[model samples]
Target: MRKVILLFAVSMALSAGVRSAEELSVDLMQSIEDTNKSLSSNIALSNKQAATADAKELTQMFAQVETFFDHKGDAKNAVDLARQSKELSTDIVGFVAVNNFESATTAATTLSRTCRTCHTFYKKE
Candidate 1:
């Protein structure tokens, strides 16, 4: 009876450990999805005629990307990738603010590539 009880407790603890790892992976995936959405929205806004529209959407999307990094645990590589992405976004916003559509478009393209690289490295199959 003692051995059986001990085995059951160990099994439960192992299952919980697996579940926590799975949960962390899920959270990371969700953060990636949110970043993708923000990137797409920024791209669309870049093509808009109104500078105000572009500025507003770009600011909001960049904010969303930044928020994803807040309170993120010690995932150093992931954090670095996100920081690169945010830097590109900052450049894009600056270009758009100056009405430099060409530069903004180039920055956006680079930002997309950064996002893809990060996803490939960190996200699971």
Candidate 2:
């Protein structure tokens, strides 16, 4: 039946989209981890320029994550966590601009923890 074929096609498209999203999220996660480590090191060294750049990149990435969750429409807590992490990234940029590495470090730690919390709750199989 045409109805059955249409339903099957729609189901296939959705499954493919889910698979693609998972792959993209995995790549994004790896990049975030690398950037987070670089950010911590930059903060420790008091590298204002590098730290600012890292924080900005983190903010952008978290925004992407927030958008991803928002589109999925199933993970409210994940969306909130991503937003909180994005705010922390922005805070880190401000702290680095002021040469306040201590506060920036603290914010980075908080951001890392926020990421862990989200992963714990919303990790993909």
Candidate 3:
């Protein structure tokens, strides 16, 4: 009975990890959407502080995604793109801090492209 219980517990833990991993993609996408919305809105309004905050949030989300990839042992494939995404996000924040919406918009485009490139390899339907 003890052996059976141990096996069941391990199975349950593994199942939970799989479920959480599946959910992580959805959460990451939502975070990206939020960042885009905030970035566009703040830029249009020339709200430097808000745009900077959004960019910072995006950087954090990308870091989380990187950690997730590492956990899945897919970091070898995604590390560069993930790093680029985070760097572009930081660039966006820096541009916004200087009230350079044009540069920030360009950085945002690069960041979006990096995310798409990474998704092409890893995102499951």
- For model 3, state the Cα shift of residue 107 in Å: 0.4
Candidate 3 runs further than 4 Å off: 1-9, 18-25
**In terms of TM-score, how similar is model 3 to the real structure?**
0.81
Error of 2 at 34 (Å): 0.4
Worst 10 residues of 1 by lDDT: 47-56
**TM-scores of the models, in the given order?**
0.52, 0.85, 0.81
lDDT of 1 by residue, 60-90 (tens): 5445444554445555666676667656666
lDDT of 1 at 117: 83
Residue 66 displacement in candidate 2 (angstroms) = 0.1
**72: Cα error in model 1, Å:** 5.1
| lDDT (10s digit) by residue, model 3, range 61-108 | 878877877776746778667777888888988888878899888888
The whole-model lDDT of each prediction reads 0.61, 0.91, 0.81
Ranked candidates, highest TM-score first: 2, 3, 1
Greater-TM-score candidate between 1 and 3: 3
